[model samples]
Target: MYERKPVQSWLTDMDGVLVHEGQPVPGAPEFINKLRSSGKPFLILTNNSIYTPRDLQARLTRMGFEVPEHALWTAALATAQFLADQRPGGTAYVIGEAGLTTALHAVGYVLTDFAPDYVVLGETRTYSFEAITKAVRLINDGARFICTNPDVTGPSVEGALPAAGSVAAMISKATGVEPYFVGKPNPMMMRSALNTINAHSESTAMIGDRMDTDVLCGLEAGLETILVLTGISTRTEAERYPYRPSRIVGSVADLMDEI
Candidate 1:
């Protein structure tokens, strides 16, 4: 029998698993502290590409969790790494905020609107009609399309707002070209995260709140997946999925003793 090794490293989602609605879930801070003190390799992952890791670190700090910048990973970073690998020093027409722009710039990608190599879409609070129109025309001309994630809606105090996935769909409908998603639910994102921390699948566990993105990505990456019920998917909702996680827990607080 080919048995897998025990989990020595961890990857966890941020929104649902650790924090929800701009607040830290109960015991979330303690769980992070335990991981930090134990010297385990872990990354706090998020699909939101609007803010940089430093910005996220500051947000988490305000929520009473002391997460370092290096321990934070975003879809923007993964997408940037993918683009850099696919076409080093390539040009792109991007419609996103500081996070996405910063990552692409760091990877030596030149952002432009004139006959660029790719049309990269990411999350942003302000979605301009002119920018979307430009992206649509650019893709129609010959640029490849890439998106950071497939999340259609994002939560806000007001309600759910259209996100990058929604905008990508609009552009696709207009140009008849689909974007290549590089975030959660795509194993590439998980692989990039693992590579960032030099962690192997056999000894790593992925803890997420959603069955679709987090659990699916982790499973596809050959890592043990744990679904926590602190966010989106409930135990009943999870049962409807075709695939199953390695285990289910009520919250991150439940796994504190293991660390």
Candidate 2:
């Protein structure tokens, strides 16, 4: 029988596992403190591409979570990294906020709509019809389609708003071209994250609140997956899936000792 190596690094989802509705989850702060004190390599992962790591770091600081910008990873960064690897110094027609645009710029991607290399879609507060129309026409013209993530709806103070996936669907319907998503549940995201931290899969653990994205991505990335109940998934709901997490805990607080 083979044995897994002891966990030396950690990757955790930011929304449900750490915060919900703009409030920090119980024991989340302590867990973060523990990781900091232990000097263990850790990252807070999120499929949200609206905000850059610096922006997210500030948001977390406001919420009393002292997370550094280097400890944060967003789908925007992952998508930009993937694109940089696939096509160095490429041009893209981008539809997103500062996060996605800034990331692409950092990776030497030129954002334009005129016969670009790719039509990249990401999360935005305002999804304009004109922009979507441009994206659709561009894809029909020959540009490849790429999406930051496949989340259909995102939470807001009002309610769930149509997200990147929803807009990607409309574009796909028009052009009959489906985009390649580079965020959660895609093992590529996990691999990129692991590479970012220089952590090995066998010695890293993933903590997530969702089975569809976080747990699934971690499992596929060969990291031990820990499902927590503070988010969208419940213990019962998790069992409905074919795969199971390595462990299930009430919250991040439960694993404080592990760090």
Candidate 3:
């Protein structure tokens, strides 16, 4: 067996690992503070495209966590970067919010339903039937489809709401077109994050609570993965998957000395 070296760079999921339901998880603040003080590059990754990095930073700050705006990496950012690389100055028909639209605009992507190069789908509080219909029609007319993440449902103050993945499925059903998801569970997203932080997979570790997205993404990208039982996934549930994380811990609290 090849001996793996100690992890240097870190990539962590935001919601489950660091905070839960907009509240800071135990020891999350200290762990983040350590990462910041250690002079190591780390990013709080999320598949949620509803809010931009600044918005998310504010949300976290309000929750008593001190994550900087630049420290947050979102699916919206990854998706926009992918689009800009694939087709610079491309036009898209976006069915998302300011986070998604702003990212695309920053990359010189124009939002239009008219002869668009891509029919982009992202997280939105309100999935307007009119907007979805326009996206479907645009795809049917030869627009390539793209989705931010594969999560079908997202939690709201009230309850679970229909997310981008849910609407993407509906559009696929109508137009017989499947979207290319650019978020977690996609190795592209992990590689893109690595590029952003200027880190190598061999020395980086990914910390997440979900096996399907965070752990899987890191594993596929050839990085060591740590699963924390602080959110959606339990130890028993994680064992059911064929893919395994390098380590399992109770929460971010336990990793205090590791950093």
Candidate 4:
């Protein structure tokens, strides 16, 4: 018989761990409700920079999850916080939705096209070639390049759509300058998520659906990693990576007892 360690603090990914294809994963709400009732800190982590915490909360609510707006943490918020620390009161030329723009605005960053401090890229419904061309020119003209996440594509009803990383690559290819990617697979964003809840890596458990991003983020950030098969990653796919998750479950439904 094996004795499972207790979860002191928890972090779970949004898309596949809790909900899949805009619907709540079976038992996700119960798991979340357990976390909420237990009095321990928890947050749903997302690499998406297109929607704000409030937006996510509402979406989750519509899907039957009662997550608070504060219970969600996004890559956009982390990127804005990073920029604020790195270069305070700076200007940028941004390509993103309200989530990215709002986060930057809260951090006192001004958005402009002319002689900005950075050319920040994020997830958007449409990636305009004209905007990307301008971004390349901005990089050539000494503006630093930054991207919210490194996800090359995102899931859609129609299939995977080109996302922030893909657009960033285009700009980089044109300008011969690589943009700094701040979302998962990068440990900084994980650290920021932990910091947001004042949680320690040793005691915190990170539940994610993807091995490359979620598991990697947790492992690199020094947190225990759990991989759920409810999303894009599979059991065999997880093994292909050099790094392994601390545990792998079929779905969030299988995690109730452990938590």
**Strongest candidate by lDDT:** 1
Over the stretch 59-123, how does candidate 4's per-residue lDDT look in tens digits?
Answer: 89988888889999999999999999999999999999999999999999999998999999999
For model 2, what is the alpha-carbon lDDT of residue 20?
89
- Estimate the TM-score of every prediction: 0.98, 0.98, 0.98, 0.97
**Over 4 Å off, model 4:** 1-5
Residue-by-residue lDDT tens digits, candidate 2, 13-78? 999999988999989988998898899899999999999999999999998898889999999999
Give the Cα error of residue 173 in candidate 2, in Å: 0.5
Error of 2 at 20 (Å): 0.7
Model 1: how far is 117 from its true place, Å?
Answer: 0.6
Displacement of residue 205 (Cα, Å) in model 4 is: 0.7
Off by over 4 Å in 1: none
- Per-residue alpha-carbon lDDT of model 3 for 35-152, expressed as tens digits? 9999999988999998999999888888778777888899999999999999999999998899999999999998887899999999988789999888888898999999999999
Clashing pairs for predicted structure model 1, backbone only? none
Assess the local accuracy of residue 238 in candidate 1 as a C-alpha lDDT between 0 and 100: 95
**Candidate 3 runs further than 4 Å off:** none
